[model samples]
Target: MTAPLHHAGFFGFDVFGTVVDWRSGVARAARPFLQRYGIGVDPFAFADQWRALYQPAMEQVRTGARPWVRLDVLQRENLELLLARHGADVATLAEDELADLNRAWERLDPWPDAVAGLTRIRRRFPIGTVSNSHVAGMVQLARFGGLAWDAILGAEMAHDYKPQPQVYLKSADVAGVPPHRFVLVAAHNGDLRAARACGLRTVFVPRPLEHGPGQDTDLEAEDDWDLVAGDFLELADLLGCP
Candidate 1:
C-alpha cells in the first residue's frame, strides 16, 4: 500500500512553473530588453520562445554531447539565440545589459499559494527545491520570491539536469531521505515519471497556464501519481495538514 505523503521525510519541489510564475516573471524581466532593441514583439510570446529552448539545451548535457554546464549559462546562451531569432538586434546591447537580462530567472515571483503552502508543509516535512536551475539562481529566486527552502537542490549540485536518474537519486541523498521516503512535487508529468522510476513518491500539481494561453500539456496528471491536487494549499490539505 502507498503510504501517506506526509509520512515521507521531505518534499522536493520543482521551482519554475510549480512554485514561481516563470512566464510572467520572465516576460516582465524581458520587456525592457525588447523595448531597448526597439523590438515590438509580444513579451509573453518572447518568454515562451525563450523557454522552448530549455529542454534541448539540457539534453545536450544529458546525452553527454556537452560538458555539464550551469543552467545559467544555458539560459544566457538561449537568450542570445532567442533575441536574434525574434529579430532583436543583439549586437546593440552592452555586455552589462545582456548580463542583467540573463538574470531574469533569478527574479521570478512565486505563485499565490506557494509561500503559505510551503510554509505549512514545512511544519511537517523539510522542503527544498529540486529544480533544473543553477544553485545560485535558485537561491536568488527564493530570496526574491520569499520562498523558504531548507536546502537548494538543483542541476548545479548534481552537475546534471532532471529526468536523469542521477539527479533524482542525488537529490534524495541531499535531502537525507531514502528514495521512497521522499516526494517529488512538480507540475510536469515527465519530471514526476522520472522521479517515480527512481523510486521516489510523486505528486502532480497542475499549472494550466504555465505556458500561458493555449497551454495544453500538464493540465492533469498523466499517470497514476500518488496525489493530484489543484494547488499547493490543496496539496497540504490532502497530506493531513491543518
Candidate 2:
C-alpha cells in the first residue's frame, strides 16, 4: 500500500458497506435463525433481500408517501419480512431479541484494514459517514469499528435517503465542506455513480464479497471516478498528500 491521501477541506465519509463489512455481520448474526427456519436459503440471498428493501423504502419517503425513517427502521422492517417468509411468527419474537438484531449494523465487523487505514487518513481529513443510518446506528458502528470520524452525517437528519443529492449535500453541509471538496469512497458502484452524478469526487473500493459467497464483485469502476483502489489503504495512497 502507498502513503495516505490528504484533503484539507473534505467532509463526510460513509459507514456501512464502506468502512465495514455489513453483509458478513448480518449473515453471522442471522445464522441461527437461518438454520432453525429450515428454509432452503443461501447467505447471499438474505443479504441481497436486505439490501433490496433499502431503495423501495427510501422511495416511500422520497415520494412523500411515507414519513422519513432511518436505515435501521427499514432493516428491521425487512427483517420481519425475512423471518415471516422463513416461518418465524413475528408475534413470538421478543422485543429485546428484535432490537438486538436491529443493532446488527451498529455491530458490523470492519474490514481488516479499516481501523488502521481510517486512523491514518483521519489525520489529514475530517472524515465522517454520509449514510442513511440513524445517529444511534452510525455512532455504534463507528465505535465498534474503531473508526475515528470527525462527524457522522445521516439521511435521517435530512428526512430522506441516498441516490438523492440532498443526502450527499447534507453530509457536505454537516461537515462544513463544499461538495467538490468531499470524496465519497464506497464498495457499491451504484452509490459511487450516484455521488458522481451529484458532482462529488468519488473513490471506488471494491468489496467483492458484499454479496457474500458465490457472488461476483463489482470489479469495474466508472471511468469518471477520481480513483479506484484495491482497498482503503491503497485508496489513501492514491489520494496523496496535500
Candidate 3:
C-alpha cells in the first residue's frame, strides 16, 4: 500500500468523527440527564437529533445571519431546540446542570485507534485538532481523552466553522505551518474539500459509523484525497511513522 503522506510539518485533525466517536460520546453523556428526567427516548437517537442540527446551526454563523458564536453556545442553543422538539422538559434542571450537560461535547471519547495513532504521528510531526469544536471544548477533550495535541486550533480561532476557508487556513496559521506544509485528516469529504481548497494536503479517514448504523454519507472518499486510511494507526503506518 502507498505510504501515508509525510512531507507536511504538521497534521490537523477533524476531531468530532475523525478522532473521537461523537455518536457514542454524546449519547453516553446524555443518558444520565435523560434518565434523571425519566425520559425514555433513545439517547442515541437524541444524540443524532442534536447532531442533525450541527451544520445548519453553524451555517447561520457562516452566512453572517448570526454573529460569530462559540461551538458551546451553539450546542446549548441546539440542545434547547432538541429538548423542545422532543417534548422533554428540562426546565427543572439548574442552569449549571444544563450547562454541564451541554459541555458533554468536551468529554467525547476517542476512537480506539486515535490515541495510539496520534502518539505515533506526534513523534514525526506536531499534531493539533482543527475541528469545528470550540477551543475550550477541544482542550477539555484532549485532557479527558489523553489526546496529546500540541495545539488546539478550530472555530474558536477562525471565529467561523468548517467548510469556511478561514477555518482551515486559520488552523495552519495557528500551528505555525504554511497551508502547503500542513495536512488535514478528516472523515468528512466536505472537510477535506475545504482543506484541499486552501492548499493543504488531505487524508480521508472513513468513519462509516460516525452517524451510527443508519449513516450513509462519508463512507468513502468522494474525491481523490492525498491519502485514504482505515483508521489513524493505519494512516500513521502509511505515513511511515514509527
Candidate 4:
C-alpha cells in the first residue's frame, strides 16, 4: 500500500454522492410530501428526476446566462419542475411546505462509513468540503450527518459550480494550498477530472448505489486517478489515517 502523502496540505471532498447518500436521503425526505399530495410516483424516481435537472440548472449560471445563485435556489426550482411534471397541483402546497421539501437537500444522511472514515482521515489532515452545495446548506447537512469539517470551500465560495475550474481553483486558494498540494476526493469521475485539470490531486471513491439499484454510471474510475478506494473506510486506510 502507498504510504500517506504527508506533503498534501488539505483534503477537500465532493459531498453529494461521495459523502452523503443524496438519492436515498432525497427520496426519504420527499416521501412525506408525495404522500400528502397523493402523488403516486415512486419517491426514488422523483429524487432521480430532481437530480436529473441539476446539471442543466447549474449550467445556466455556469455559462453566465443566469446570475450566480446558491444551490438551494436551483434545487427549489428543480423541485417545482418535478412537482409540475408529476402533475402535482403546486398551488395547494403552502410556502412552508415547499420550503421544507426543498430543504431536503440539507438533511441528507451520510453513508454508513462516511462519518467514521472522515473522522479517521481528519486525524491526519485538515478536511473541508469542495461541493457545489451552498454554505448554509452545507452547514445544515454537516450538522444533520455529524460531519466534522474544518472549512467549507466550494461553489458558494467560488460563485461557480463543479466541473468549472474556478470551483476547484478557488477552493484551493481558500485553503491556502497550492493546487497540486490539495487533494480532491469524489465519487464522480468528471469531478475528479476537473479537479485534476486544475492541478489538484484526485481520489476516486466509487459509489455504485448512489443513483439507486438500477444505476449504471460512475461505478468505477474512468481515468487514472491518483488513488481509488471502494468506500470511505478503504480511502481512510489508503491515506493511512489513524
State each model's C-alpha RMSD to the native. 1.4, 2.9, 1.6, 1.2
Which residue runs does candidate 1 get wrong by more than 4 Å? Answer: none
Quote each prediction's TM-score.
0.96, 0.89, 0.95, 0.97
Candidate of highest TM-score? 4
**Candidate 4 structure quality by residue, lDDT tens digits, 128-205:** 999999999999999999999999999998899989999999999999999998999999999998899999999999
Q: Which 10-residue window of candidate 4 scores lowest in summed lDDT?
A: 1-10
> What is the full ranking by lDDT, best candidate first?
4, 1, 3, 2
- Residue-level lDDT tens digits of model 2 in 112-157: 8777777766766767888888988888887787878788886977
Candidate 3 per-residue lDDT, tens place, 43-148, comes to: 9999998999999999999999999999988999999888877777758666887898898889888999999999998988899989888878888989999999
Candidate 4: regions farther than 4 A off: 1-4
lDDT of 1 by residue, 40-63 (tens): 788899898899999999999999
Shift of residue 154 alpha carbon in model 2, Å: 2.7
Prediction-by-prediction clash tally: 0, 2, 3, 0
- Model 3 segments beyond 4 Å from truth? 1-4
For model 2, which pairs clash? 13-128, 13-129
- Which residue pairs clash in candidate 3? 3-238, 4-238, 4-239
Tell me the lDDT of candidate 1.
0.90
Candidate 2 residue-wise lDDT at 103? 79
